[model samples]
Target: MSTSTAAAPVVADERVASKGPVAKLLGRPEIGALVGAIALFVFFAVVAPVFLQPSSIATVLYGASTIGIMAVGVSLLMIGGEFDLSTGVAVISSALTASLFSWYFSTNMWVGVVLALAVSLAIGFVNGWILIKTKLPSFIVTLATFLMLTGLNLGLTRLIGGSVSSPSTSTMDGFASAKAVFASSVNLAGVDVNITVFIWIALVAVASWILLRTRVGNWIFAVGGDANAARAVGVPVVRTKIGLFMGVGFCGWILGMHNLFAFATVQSGEGIGNEFLYIIAAVIGGCLLTGGYGSAVGGAIGAFIFGMANKGIVYAEWNPDWFKFFLGLMLLLATIVNLVVKKRAEAK
Candidate 1:
């Protein structure tokens, strides 16, 4: 007798589920920051009418760009699971290097600029190398670098320049050209917007692309998530970390050039605590302290929020003294919101 066996039923995999658009959007690390930015913008617009003015908007953008430039690198470094406490002083050091070298040697400003770039990259390499070799926490490694650089910035400037600041480089060869590239401004709809703003935008765009679309980006996430696992999977953990630190140095070099060209002098004492601002911006942008998550866009939004709060207080005619309190509150609230959003997304 011929008997036909019943066919087995097809079963869909329970582990895979199709996510809708809303779920996908919420899944982004920057989503909470985006919401916060919108709220902040509205609050400022309502409280300070002048904040909406074109000139005021330009000022806000200028302020944002300054921090945002460094935030680009700082955010990336955070995502790669590391910190660079030396960044603040490193910037001033770069500017000082360019200024002192050019003025002392009576050479072209370009020469000093190139030399400063080398010095900055070397500093990054040293920091990374030490971290890799010693397996010390990046915090300690960079903190040591920070202290050393702070001392060097002051001691060297005093010894070489005979003062706490470098000599004026406005008349040096290539000074004008460099200034035009780094410190010039553009007129947009009757408002002057600093060149650094455009540069910051370019940096954000490039960094976002690198983080989202390249093999290097994959390696970054992999290492940040778990260095040992990443190494086991053939990722270049050492190179990636070193490259990230170098990226921070590159950013420092750019900002340093801007400062020197913009003012024609470098103050050894400047940029002492600005590293915290960069780190705060990255954190507010949704980068976890533990790392392995965050986006360039989120950092940009964080910087924008900072600009608003900084300028908004003045526009509202409030006491500037309260700005710090406001900042701290924002930081705490942002962190909580980010954590909540992350958990909710994961649940989805």
Candidate 2:
């Protein structure tokens, strides 16, 4: 009896093993982004002699870090079947808010930091709440926020800082510590690596863990796949969306602080149109425009590709105007590749 049972399980395991690793990898959401990134790297490396230089790599990573931070946030939210148009201006809004408060009260930089975080979180909450309450499309809801924040950023900066940009907070109290936390750099192999790189990496790690190892992650996929179906199955769609947006707000705070401390001043007019880059990076990372299929690491890889192409064009001495053309072409190509990959993955 025991021997018969052992062989039964063994045969089942052997049969499952026949699927092969290639098929398994192809099924993963990140596969397309990974392949595209590799291809792009090779293309640039061949055409741009200096693309392989140490400092050049650092520049690419730095650019990725800046966009990657937000990419992580939007990726998570996108995986939950939503978009946040306000994200771009929200970044500038937070920076302006922090700088204005810090300058106004002559308080510790942390004071402004804390207040700015609160404000950002509130903005996220409002965006989510309004969407849920109105039953409108997220695109419409967040577009309104984008417009509102764009105005408030400019208006508030002028009202408080008396200029289109916030006053410098470089010499404010607690500036040094804040700088260390948000804007400091470390020497890595004789190359200066911004602290944002570490932060972005950590975020990707945590997000991947959340999406893969936690119950919340399951809910995210389910909700994005179908909110009504997820809710019927007892998933809290509202909280999940609200939390996702709040997560975006949290990243906004981090990036905003970095902007403030890195430059010591905040430009209210900055960050407009940057949201498109974040969305594009996330899309390129394997997150579907329709939602419910993506990964945090994919988002990072997508940003890496963006960063590489950004600097690679300069290194290749190509016209900057052609960058968008490359992006559009890549987007179309990647989508087609991913569609085939997903179909293959689900075929079994």
Instruction: Provide the TM-score for each candidate, comma-separated.
Output: 0.95, 0.95
lDDT of each: 0.91, 0.90
Deviation in Å, model 1, residue 286 alpha carbon: 0.8
Residue-wise lDDT of candidate 1 within 168-244, one digit each (tens)? 98998999988998999999988999999999999999999999999999988888889999999899999999999
> Which residue runs of candidate 1 sit more than 4 Å off their true CA positions?
1-18
Reference-based lDDT, residue 262, model 2: 96
RMSD of each: 4.8, 2.5
Off by over 4 Å in 2: 1-17
